[model samples]
Target: MRQYQAVEETGMSINKKIRHIENTIVLSPSFKQAIAMIRECHERSKLTTEPKCMLLIGNTGYGKTTIANHYVGQYARVVSKDGTTVPVFYSMIPSNATIKGLACRLLEDLGDPLYDRGTTINMTSRLCRLIKECKVELIILDEFQHLIDRDSDRVLRSTADWLKDVLNRTKVPIVLMGMPNANSILTVNPQLMRRFANICELKAFNWNPVKERDDFLRFLIMIEKATFFPQPSILHSNEIALRIFCATKGVVSYIKKLISKAAEIAYVKNLDRVTTEALALAYNDELALSNTMSNPFLVDHENLNIPSLEQSFHNSSDAARHGGKRRVAEILRR
Candidate 1:
């Protein structure tokens, strides 16, 4: 009975730490900049007849969604004399996003019960009308890269044209958030290219000694403060911080995971604080890094295993960017 109680307590304690990290987003410098830029776009959107569009591009787990949520929180939906006034309208591009699916998604966000019931044109008219009726100042669409996944040129062009028509009809400033390759959707259609003049990006932290390192450490410190388990987190310490950077490649989500995993290990074992051993074990479990030598927490790092800023930002397909296919070929041959 006592053993079962101890196990339950351990699970509960670790779960609290994980939940704390998951629920709270500790804003990084890039995250703050993205927010500022979005605010600027919102302000600029209000004053002009020709609405300015912003393309917010980032890799997975870079906190682009968090920025969008933050903006939406600031200008909440309100009941007014006329009707509901939604300063910001936010939705995601639907999976297998066709023209009709896109319209239905927008209609659904605008509170239409039978969103899926309308034809493409019917839903488009409804969306435009709601934007005007609700006095919506900005429209934010996330996961826009869904339009590109496994699509042919003809379908891509059709979807792009549909988006252009929406922009023309609504005349509301829009923020399109997607993965880095999402720019391809714009490049395919020059009309969209012209609409989206302002571009913002959220990126992982780099291993620069002067500015970036301090920024990363500060961000980690903030996250550590938020975790409910204990204090004096060793994650912000110099050596551990560098190892974390190497492990996560400075990606915000990966960093949070590593810290949370380490916290779990510490909590379950009744340790007071996170340790390198806990971190090492977490590193092995969380990441798919097959190279044992590259395990930052376990191995003594001679140098940071981070890619250059230029290399990280290079535009390429995922398959092209990763060379793991060669290893697969070798394994098959054996």
Candidate 2:
């Protein structure tokens, strides 16, 4: 008789290198527009009198960073229609930054340091001069939401005004990346809003069957295949994928972690394919606050202490139907 590896006991290995990039979704038209504009700014750096500025707004894990990275990569190599060359410099705005600190970061990115000794105003003047001299065109400020923590609204308003002033003085494009809430912040400040005349919002993945599913799944499978190097594994069926979608609610970061954990379980059991059993086991094993793996009353597989995991398929199926919402509520209330 052949022996079956207990689903509860499986251990799967995962490729960490691949997991890092799994969170990035394919670029949509909105994302492409941001890329196009950023490139235009870089390509027109030497010629344009007025600088271009864009503000990118999005929820977490919505590929804001990835899109920004992609923009930098493309713009760094921009070539003119007549085969002329342009240099694109990239700089990150430091978290919890003041105007002087931001100027320092920009100076550092340009391979120099502001040596002028005086108040913040003096430093700002020196930095502006350097930016003009260097002909820097594009400035990307990531995590710009931190500026809101200023104790005085005046400070915040001044920061916004100063940034607007810098852009006008330098004639350089600026891209601000931050959480969704940052959009409201920018809208409230007239100066900031004017600078961000062209706004782009990045949203989470939408599994609309018409256009996204193909690229989305390919992106997913690519991560899975690359993460589990040497020994490739396939999902037992689409059902497993659906379960994953339901469990993670399409959060790319959580999806990778759940799948990686499942693969680790499968690897431990020496299984070549990831089974529903392994997936369930992995789901149950996840200790994060967001996990919807197994219902509280549903019981775990025979060996696990989760009573709900031990419940019969009929009850488990019912739990799956109600989505274990009641059970989860009960657990939370406790």
Candidate 3:
């Protein structure tokens, strides 16, 4: 096969091959828009007295963190006479994060070695000083929903107030990213909600509207270009596209995982290209899909049941609640 010949000629190692496949990042339409929005907000924050904050909400594995990381990379740390200046700072909210814990995490990200030793007040004071010292213009908090406890109203209000206090003191734009439930933290605090007036939602792809389907196919082509197979795989074909959509429920992350696994399996088996059998095997092996469900790739397009496919999607979402591995297993069981 062409791919096999190319691999042999180059003598590429398996580790390098896997890294090449894993490192591909497609700049989809939504991702591009998010980058633009972040830049605009960052620029506006520099000139305005009031911070222009944004809430970025989406399902898990919907590229929310990836977009934030991309934006941060654009303004990586700059060396100057004074010290290192980080234009964009990023941190993750610890699960059930408290005001003190949040403060310590921010301090740690700011390069403070003694962050964990400080009390809440001491940490907040140091955090404010470091923010100015480091010249940080924007802060991104991923998994921001963890700031509030669902069971305690007192904890929720205190944490929300702490965030507002930080914004008032720093006047730096903050982007909070997390699952859709992250909105609840804002809904409970009107002042905080009003401050973060600019809200962005990252949605998964759907087969509706011819354009969406066409765009997904284009995305597949992009993925195929990055993926190294023994031979060319017609991933953009209508049959494969429909089957992939059914299997992944239009989630880009899931699609990437499925393709990567299938590619790896094809490479190991010395196959010319990924076939329906390889895809089915990948689905079972990587996703732990239950044998009870029909394999999308193996079934006829016309015979595919919409309700059953949707149930698979629902199961995937439900499984996400528990964790990644469990979620996959749960979906297959359904």
- The candidate maximizing lDDT is 3
Q: Among all windows of ten consecutive residues in candidate 2, which has the lowest summed lDDT?
A: 1-10
Q: Write the per-residue lDDT of candidate 2 for residues 1-334, one digit (tens) a residue.
A: 0113332222332444324435434455556776777676556655766666777877776667777778667645334554423245666666566777777776666655444346777767876776666555677777777666545433355566778888887777788888876666676787777767777776544344425444445545765654443344444134344445555555555566667776667656656556567776767776336654452213432212323222532365556665444543332232
Ranking by lDDT: 3, 1, 2
- Number of residue pairs clashing in candidate 1, backbone atoms closer than 3 angstroms, sequence gap of 3 or more or interchain: 0
**What lDDT tens digits, residue by residue, belong to model 3 across residues 1-334?**
6656655553666567667767787888888888888888899988988989998989988999889988888888887888879889999988788899889889888888898986898888888888988999999989987876756733367877898999888888999899888788888889999999998899887654567777788888888877666467888786677778777777888888888888777776667677778888887776545335577777655445344334555575553465444533332333
RMSD of each: 8.1, 8.9, 7.3
TM-score of 2: 0.67
Error of 1 at 155 (Å): 6.6
Flag regions of model 1 displaced more than 4 Å.
Answer: 1-14, 79-83, 149-155, 228-231, 289-293, 303-334
List TM-scores for all candidates, in order: 0.83, 0.67, 0.87
**Candidate 2 regions with alpha-carbon error over 4 angstroms:** 1-34, 44-48, 74-86, 114-117, 150-155, 208-210, 228-237, 264-269, 277-287, 291-334
Q: Candidate 1, after superposition: displacement of residue 89 in Å?
A: 1.1
Model 1 per-residue lDDT tens digits across residues 1-334: 4433543553555566578777777777788888888888889878988888999999998888888998899898998777888889999998668899788888888877788886787888888998898888889999988778564523366877888888898888889999988888888888899999789988788755448877888888887876544447657776777778778878888888888888778767766667788888888888746434467776544333534532533343543655544422322232
Model 2 lDDT at residue 10: 26
* Consecutive 10-residue window with the lowest summed lDDT within model 3: 325-334
